[model samples]
Target chain A: MYGKKVKLRIFFFSIIFLAILLTTFLILKSLEENVVYFISPSDVKVLPELSKKKIRIGGMVKKDSIETNAKEILFIITDYKSEIKVSFSGSIPNLFAEEKGVVAEGFLKDRNYFTAKKILAKHDENYMPPEVKKALESKK
Target chain B: MFNIFSPSKIFSITSRATKYVFAIFILIISVGLIEALFLSPKDYIQSDSVRIMYVHVPAAWISLGIFSLIALLSISILIFKNKTFSLIAKSLAPSGFIFSIIALVTGSIWGKPTWGTWWAWDARITSMLILGLFYLMYIVAWRVISPNNANKVTSIIAIIGVVNIPVIKFSVDWWSTLHQPSSINILSKSTIHHSMLVPLIIMTAAFALFSLLIFLMKYNTELIKIKNKGLDRL
Candidate 1:
């Protein structure tokens, strides 16, 4: 009787254990739908489907391309080969400058313009990405 | 006179009592989810995105909490040869990993529109990445090591890795960089509104309880496994 009780307890707990794992996996998979992505300027150009979706385009803000009107700033974002225009009506951070990597979050109304709600600089001196460097060099 | 509640017995009440405990856990978690999801008013600045706070913050807390628990338990097992302690440490690991992943994923969702970047390598974020990596390594270690050899080896790793937790946590503020300082806690300037705060509190409490209950159940299973296999001596 004692042995049977022990076996039953193990059986019950194992079911619970498997249930916990299954629930976690299902929740995680559902959450996966919301995970968004950031695309390079070049990557954005090729994927026609993404043109209608809310997306982020990240690259350097071209020097001399930034224009301002009533504290709202307008600038051109580039992946070296193609340029996308971004306009933002907010105070710019100190790191926000031309020739630095910036990710502009908004949607493309057309293929050429990107209206931005937020902008952030990709700043990490030690962790310079190889691809961005390659992109820069190819332009030269 | 010598019932299940005897001094030596360990909460071995009738199965009906255990059912009640399960019901209480379910009730608390349900209330917590509702409060976190519906009752809490949006942040004045962040609005609905801030709702992510309910799930993200508690998961992050549990991730760190479990790491500490594992580190402490590892220490106890090493210093005292306390078999129960090592078992507890091992049992708590997956819960920690789950919450850590939750924190990372929820953080990304909250950041998508707000931060403008899906992910960043800022101090808090990078350290969090490391924390997540450490979690993976810890799990892999359990799988790779022999059962008899696992305890002492993992203990050393756990103790050494504890230092990284503080580094991951403090790196953001120290750098004067991006990624805002801890919100929903000491560094935040604005107080959370009562409606949102209530659910935040409830969900956090529920998450902690869930983690605890899971830990207990897992711990019990490990004990049984060891006993059945006569590996308790190892």
Candidate 2:
């Protein structure tokens, strides 16, 4: 029931669609190398290797562990069970506080040390996204 | 299925529904705003900044949902050669684009307080930005291209753009991003406390009602335009 013109048009559009898909695939493949993986302080302790690639670590800032110096701020991030020391030399976000959840993007200097390139102050500790809260509860 | 109604009948039905939809939208918004802004308890961590979720999440959801609907309708258009499908797609684009922009703007506002920056190239944000761009492209195709060919071309874009839906949905799991993962799961009970979830759910319903009201009005206008074209041909 279809006309020859419609068939020709479909074929023509198919070629264009394939070209777009191929371009998107290539770009994502290249970007995959640069994407950072997020981990908790506890996850870092169990890593098989000291990854040189940048990664993100998220956890609550340990109370009483924050210290400030002339050009740097130091804090300890804890998953309650494990803690890792973090140091940064940049202006911190206003929301950054002790006992608050935060995610830091940086390279792991060693098993015990993390030098954060940027600090992401997470929302209220009670504000666990439903998905995250569910995931956390499921793990428990 | 939609063809069962004459153009005049469609207009009358939509006009009658508009009153109830508008009232519902108003009721929901008033309740949602009060709950979101004043009644809901401040997040233990993010504080009041968590309120932005009421608007931001719904806008993002509507944008994605509209595009997916357009894609589905486009499939019907190709299969059935129905003009009504294209017209409905046309009707949905402006609001879709508007909600997409709102989502981005609200997201940036929300991000500034929590993420330490207004914008980041995180996977979720990047993919959402692309989604907004695709919405603009779809809208532009309808406006600038001739009517004869616009339906075919825009439908093609809609279908192809479906690829981004899964990407946006899975971005949090697929990449490490500053944006938090989706919380309101459909498969299971939401982890959000009932007090907060009530307002969020209400706001989502309000937004959906508003979208439907806009869509109905636009659909009526489109049908009139098509009728005019028929008259001109005769």
Could you say which candidate leads in DockQ? Answer: 2
Please identify model 2 stretches exceeding 4 Å from their true place.
Answer: A1-30, A37-65, A76-85, A94-101, A105-117, A123-140, B5-8, B230-234
Q: In the order shown, what is each candidate's alpha-carbon RMSD? A: 15.8, 5.1
Give the top-scoring candidate (lDDT): 2
Residue B58, candidate 2: how far off, in angstroms? 1.1
Across residues B1-234, which tens digit of lDDT does each residue of candidate 1 receive? Answer: 213323113323322244555677799989887776676555533546677878987888889888978988776566556665676688788888889999999988876755556776555776687778877878788779998888878776676566667665655544433455454555444334455667767877778877777766766566556557865243
Output the worst ten-in-a-row residue range by lDDT, candidate 2 chain B. Answer: B225-234
Q: Give me the displacement of residue B222 in model 2, in angstroms.
A: 1.6
- Per-prediction DockQ comes to 0.04, 0.28
DockQ, model 2, C-alpha based: 0.28
**For model 1, how does the per-residue alpha-carbon lDDT over A1-140 read when each residue is reduced to its tens digit?**
33565566547545754665566447535743332225666766776564566677777889899899986889999979988888888755545777876777788876777888778864432211234445657999
Candidate 2 CAPRI classification by DockQ:
acceptable
lDDT of 1 at B64: 88
Interface CA root-mean-square deviation for model 1: 15.8
lDDT of 2 by residue, A27-103 (tens): 77787845543678888999989979888898899999999999899999999989899999897887798887788
